[model samples]
Target: MAEQQTDFDVLIVGAGLSGIGMAAHLTEKCPGRSYAILERRGNLGGTWDLFRYPGVRSDSDMHTLGFDFEPWRHEKSIADAPAILDYLHRIVADRDIGPNIRFGHKVISADFDMANARWDIVAETEDGERKRLSASWLYLGSGYYDYDEPYDPGFATERFEGQIVHPQFWPEDLDHAGKKVVVIGSGATAVTVVPAMAARAAKVTMLQRTPTWMFARPAKDSIANFLRRMLPEQTAYRITRWKNMKLQSLAFKRARTKPQKMGEALHKRIEKVLGENFDAEAFTPPYDPWDQRLCLVPDNDLFEAINEGRAEIVTARIEAFEKDGVLLSNGRFLPADIIVTATGLKLCVAGKIAVSVDGEPVDFAQRFYYKGCMFSNLPNLAVVFGYLNASWTLRADLNSDYVCRVLNHMARTGADMAVPVLPHGHGLEEDDIFDFSSGYIQRSKHLMPKNATRYPWRLNQEYLVDRKRMASEPITDGILEFSRARQDQGAAPEMAAAE
Candidate 1:
């Protein structure tokens, strides 16, 4: 029942892309600092390890998705789950990060002791054993979506006689070969699952209430492959990463500024592929391009499946799930033996960990985001919520680098606590930083932290501008206040029983 002591200088939550990347940065940039990664799951690789559905792959290219410190040697820029896991494993092994990770340790709550300037952490194992731990600083890389549950569209599954599955929890024993499979939803998951299950399933149908904008591109980056062959591994990786980042930025800008033109171009591309059988209504979304994320169909796999008549798209309202399959509002019934709900993810913030400061609960929605990593008035804490338009790791890499710089700065200045202080009467306009119409984004918009109109206070979407600003901007910009703990709080508490 005694108070737990600080166990590590930094306690990083989650062992996913962001967590591992942050640990790697710590090793390189702030070598003397001691850190530990607490992962709730048994294994690492976060999303890659969690998702077991067929044809699971990255929507973003690997050149940009891979860590900035590590060179991505994989040939396919659009990598599958296994390959991505392998890459992550290699990073852990090479960086000696495996020893620093505590698996099956789920963080339940974290309370920052303002007097001591340290965080008191409570984590529970899978078996429900609670352990106390503490750290000088906390970093949350727990990802954006809920790991325990996927978004439920409130489908009445009891009416269906056949098997039902959600892509988030794909059954290992389930077989689709020769079965009529229908995937519900038009997001990236549905797009990936339809083509993947088409080769085996007798017929794969993608059922959607509304059309989602789609873009087709080759799975392999020809330019990256060529550069890899000609140039050294590291050099090629750097060049390819830079090139892809620029291209991604340009594409997003065009989509935002010229949505009509971009939408038309996407439509034309789909028309060229689908040819005579192209359904304009099914391919064209009511909203503009990048309104929701553009579904990236690598190698035209989704289109190829549709073109081959193996998979089809049904753009209609689901009246109900009948005994055999889904009955549409238009009086059309789609027959299916197996149904996979590729319905989107349920978004979560800070891994749903209960956070507080000096017994006062921290409601992130009321606080403003500081430098897209830290929050206003939160001491010794940083959270990684990556980019929506570009690769998630792009922001992950930047945030990790920025955190490392902050950590090093703190050590140099002998400051025990650092918090972004927003004074009253500060003239700052609130802005909707997410600015996306995606269902998940819209659903969780109220849960997210506030953002200002200017730099350092807002979560900037443009990576190029962020990269320069993060690299060059001074840490002591008066906004982020740094201070030492009071001597009256007593000497540093000794280590408690920590897992």
Candidate 2:
């Protein structure tokens, strides 16, 4: 194995929305800092590029999903994968961040050397060549889900003779025209795929063990468009973004505080769409709204498909897969030429990259999340985990800005190392970072970092609250300790401060 060494002031992993946004922030806020982005894939646009499934689109509006610095100029707020990719491409091209990207460099592990106050990283290329690099700060923009392998529900595939497909790894050549398609699962993917496949397929059916709350809204935001026409692009974008954030926060609070009313309201909206044909029980979930994310159907496309007799929803447990279709627990058989598994994702911590401090492997589940970005007792490392209730980019933008602030503070204070130190015996009540009841969240909670009940110690779900705290909170909080390393002896600490 060949080896190479390189150094940068900061290193960003995964050139997805988070990674690209962080780099753009660096250019704007920390121009003097040297940085590079390492992407395991050959191309950019992480999730947007990876999931090629039919009707893959953002459930969240693009106004908030877009970067704080960049304005979303698209007509459709709920954008498809290609539109999202185009937005990302524009950012990369306009900001000139393309040259700094190192594609096909998959990060295997990162070790923080406390003595030197830097991170030693090991990354492997596509050809199995190992390369070594060092950076003062490591930012993990890699998403929380496992990219190599998706979650499997363990279906009996041998009994089914027809074609089966997983949305995560959708085959480009598979044809569904004039075929009967049965999609399993009731989340966002299933809702999106059923309607999309129904366009060409003879019939499409969504099979779910339980129902999910659904909300129908126009894909194009008239208010946003009107604002854009009346005001300048940036002004319009800012106004719309702030408006959406407030609405999102209010809706989330209402769902938590008064789930019954919110759930009723959502059902009523769907009832209006389906009218006499509405299946009240099939549209209602046992749990409250926002327990799992509420699926958004743009322009009532899913409901429209159902009303047109092109697509239908079947709520039942799967007994097994037969030769031609799915066998329901109720002994009902659904004929299908193609079966699509829209199962949830398999979540992983820090892109499955092994991280250690002073050669000791770090168990994230045992560590507390610091300020929603960095971890307790971990130096010069930050991870971007987005919000559960709001647009993911909302949290991503805040985290990127917070990281830039930290880096700038270090330069101004001449500190070579910074870590959020949770002293022993500190009585911070531990809390769950994610309060979601979704299968993906429930399945992967064990792999997540610890969260505290207080501010600056938890991954907060409130976007507006987080936005203010991340921007205004003092970076020199006593919990985060900063220190300088001695030049004479690499092992000697010259000075340490927790100002």
Maximum-TM-score candidate = 2
lDDT of 2 by residue, 19-78 (tens): 999999999999999889999999999999999988999999999999889999999999
**Per-residue lDDT of model 1, residues 130-153, tens digit only:** 999999999999999999988888
Error of 2 at 241 (Å): 0.2
lDDT to native, each model: 0.90, 0.90
lDDT of 1 at 72: 85
Q: How accurate is candidate 2 locally (lDDT)?
A: 0.90
Show where candidate 1 strays beyond 4 Å: 1-6, 488-499
